[model samples]
Target: MSIRILTAALFLAIMGLLVAQRFSLPPELTVRVAASLGEDAGYGFGEGLRRGSVVETGDGFLQLTIGVELENLDQAKTILWLAPNTRIELERLYEDEMTIRFTRGRIIASNETDVPLKIKTNYTSHLVLDDVASFVNYDFLETIHVIPLSGSVQVNAGSSESLLTPVPLAIHETDPVTFEKLEVNLEAGDAAEFYRWAGVLTGL
Candidate 1:
């Protein structure tokens, strides 16, 4: 083969490898909480918490902040659930600092007690919300990690579908659901648009 042809072939092969690596790598989602008034300090990642460490907000509410690793703004919405009364503010981070604000929503807290929430993702699925009935809905299946900000959540895999179910609670709460598998390309910008469409369809 000619030197020019060989060089071009090598370049193409390198590009392919880079693209594959980008898609195969999983992103990390970090969650942080502030110390409550009169409290000594807050919990960090992998820290043990008491049975009832979560405290009620002074305004008759509880506040929890979750930092999710999303390919873009759209994917962020899939992993977040905002109650009507609960306020949600989206902030971008750069090297561990809030850099920009993307979106925010308010979720209404139904009961005073803590509610179970679930988030599920895998190599073949995007972020999925689970409730009691079954796999209610799913976005593109491209997520690599699942992070639960509050309560207990579980993820189950099956043929043609994946299940995300919230653990039962002592009080009345929302039911967990599962999601159907959908093919999505993680390396392209289209993934962001796909999640945007999902958010609209799910009213998120």
Candidate 2:
């Protein structure tokens, strides 16, 4: 009967949708706030966040009052640690690329997948290499201070581009350094280790 055929078609469509979702990249990232991160920190991750919250891409900006860890789903396999007082937005997400807009603050990024992670700041955009640990810091005035621990990052601003090794790239916001090689006294991995946070954290 015509009714039976229509029901079968509807069932087939549902199954097809399910199959597609099963193979696609997960649309959300798990947010974990440490117990020490005070209650104010919860207000920053405000996309209907709860314990073990999973925030989807483009949910809105996350302005943290304390440091928190964002872990991608098992399929994506990436982790981002957002430092305190940091504000960032999940810019875009795709099967082959993931991007984050750095409004301010620091992010310790570890990308495990081959999908290139792109970080966009006010002055420049950086392509984080796969399997590399990167320490990205964007302050209110300093703007940029990226330290690649192992691999290099493709720093781009408009048509300019450069693949920079583990070197200090600290510059004032007015003087944005895009393609040029910035040399600082600190070697690679030293900044990430010795760079001090502004204040001490004490839990009650």
Candidate 3:
């Protein structure tokens, strides 16, 4: 009888240890603040960012004069450009998913891995995914622009949704969320300018 009691006690102790380990394990993934340019381009959570600082954007503007890369969170890479007035924040970030919220500005996201990327703006949300995909999110005053530079993406606004290929698309903030495609296109000069801006910032 004493032997059986001892065995049961050992089993309980093992189970307790297992449970403690399970709950105490460190997080598998984190959003590393890879690089930042310009002044005041810092993170929330009150921790100073170095090469591998895990942080999230705060309420104020990113103050990104050149560019910033929020990388290595669940195999995702997000490049933010020089938006002086735009408000950026990271709403949720986990092992399998990430949500980026911003008021106005532009961002380049490269998420060709297994983890999914979600961009939340003032009026629209975009799900970005592809085997070898790259996308751009440009938030204007009255419109939100989504450009699929390489692969494809799914754009969602209100109750409406659409799949975007390598075309430039825009979603008006006042319109109902539907699968309606607007006639707005990124002009050649504008595209050139945008590419130039992105290229310059990327080089820095």
Q: TM-score, each model?
A: 0.22, 0.54, 0.55
Q: Candidates 2 and 3: which is better by lDDT? A: 2
Candidate 3: tens digits of C-alpha lDDT, residues 145-175:
6766566677776674555555556566665
Compare the candidates by lDDT and give the number of the best one.
2
The TM-score, computed over Cα atoms with residue i paired to residue i, of candidate 1 is 0.22
Higher-scoring candidate on TM-score, 1 or 2: 2
Q: Report the error of model 3 at residue 102, Å.
A: 2.1
| Tens digits of per-residue lDDT for model 1, 1-204 | 699999999999999999998786443234333112222223232232222233222222222333432223222222322212222233332222221111112121111112223222222222222321112122232222232222223444434544443432111111233333333232256233323322322432
Q: Which stretches of candidate 2 lie over 4 Å from their true place?
A: 1-40, 43-76, 134-139, 171-204
**Residue 3 lDDT in model 3?**
100
Models ranked on TM-score:
3, 2, 1
Worst 10 residues of 1 by lDDT: 104-113
Off by over 4 Å in 1: 1-8, 11-13, 16-30, 35-64, 67-156, 160-204
Give the TM-score (vs. native) of candidate 2: 0.54
Q: How large an RMSD does model 2 have?
A: 9.3
Question: On a 0 to 1 TM-score scale, where does candidate 3 land against the true structure?
Answer: 0.55
